[model samples]
Target: MAEIQTTTLIDDLTGKPLDAEKAHRIHFSVEGKTYRLDVDEKGADEFHAALDRFIEVSTKVAAGGASKRAAAAPRRASAGSGEQTKMREWAKANGYEVAERGRIPAAIQEAYAAAN
Candidate 1:
C-alpha cells in the first residue's frame, strides 16, 4: 500500500487567510479507502483541479458551497512587459543577487511572487 497526504495553510475564496478553527472539513472515500481534507480557498484552482475533481466526484463537497481560493492565481505579467524581466529588475533594485543570465533562484521567485 502507498499513501500521501499534506497540509497547507487554508485560505478563503478571496485569498485571505482563513481561521483553521472555523474552517469546515470534507470527508469521503474511494477505492476502499477514506480521506478527509479541510476546505481551502487556494485548493480548487487549476493547479489542484485534479484533486478537486476527485474529491468532488467522490463526495458532496460542492453541495456545501465551498469555494477555491481565486486570489492567489499567478498574475500574468502584461504582454511585452513580461514577469521575468520585472522580476530581474525588482531583484536588482532590492539588492538581491541574481544571475546575470539563466534561471532566477527559487528564493527570488518566491519573493517576486509575494511582491506581485
Candidate 2:
C-alpha cells in the first residue's frame, strides 16, 4: 500500500491558499520587535511597496541586529551647499540605498566625511 501527504500554505493576511511557487516569507522588524509573514507574490509586493517610503529613509540593520547609526549615536550633519546631493551620490555609488529626500543616515554622512 502507498500513501500520499499534502500540505497547503495560506497567506496570513488574505487567508487564501497560496500556490507553492508563489509563496513568500517576509521578515521585518519594528520598534525592536521582529516578525515573519507568509504571503503570496502579490501580497509580498504590496507589503514592500507600502513600506518603501519608510524603508528608504531607514538604516539597514545587520543580521545580528546592530546598525551603524545606532552604534554611532547622535551625530550632526555638516552644513554646506549640495551636501545632501553629494551624500546621496556617494551613497548610491558605494551601494547604499538612500531615499530621494529625507533625514540622511548618519553613517552616510560619516562615510562621506571620511572619503572626502
Model 2 regions more than 4 Å off? 66-116
> Model 1: how far is 24 from its true place, Å?
58
Given candidate 2, what's the lDDT at residue 80?
A: 64
Number of colliding residue pairs in each model: 1, 0
Where's the lowest-lDDT run of ten residues in candidate 1?
A: 61-70
- What is the C-alpha lDDT profile of model 2 across 1-116, one tens digit per residue? 99999999999989999998889999987776779999988899999999999989988867767433555576564656487888889899999999988877888878888999
Scored by Cα lDDT, where does model 1 land? 0.64
Looking at candidate 1, what is the lDDT of residue 106? 79
On a 0 to 1 TM-score scale, where does candidate 1 land against the true structure?
A: 0.30
TM-score of each: 0.30, 0.51
* lDDT assessment of candidate 2: 0.85
True-structure RMSD, every candidate: 20.5, 19.2
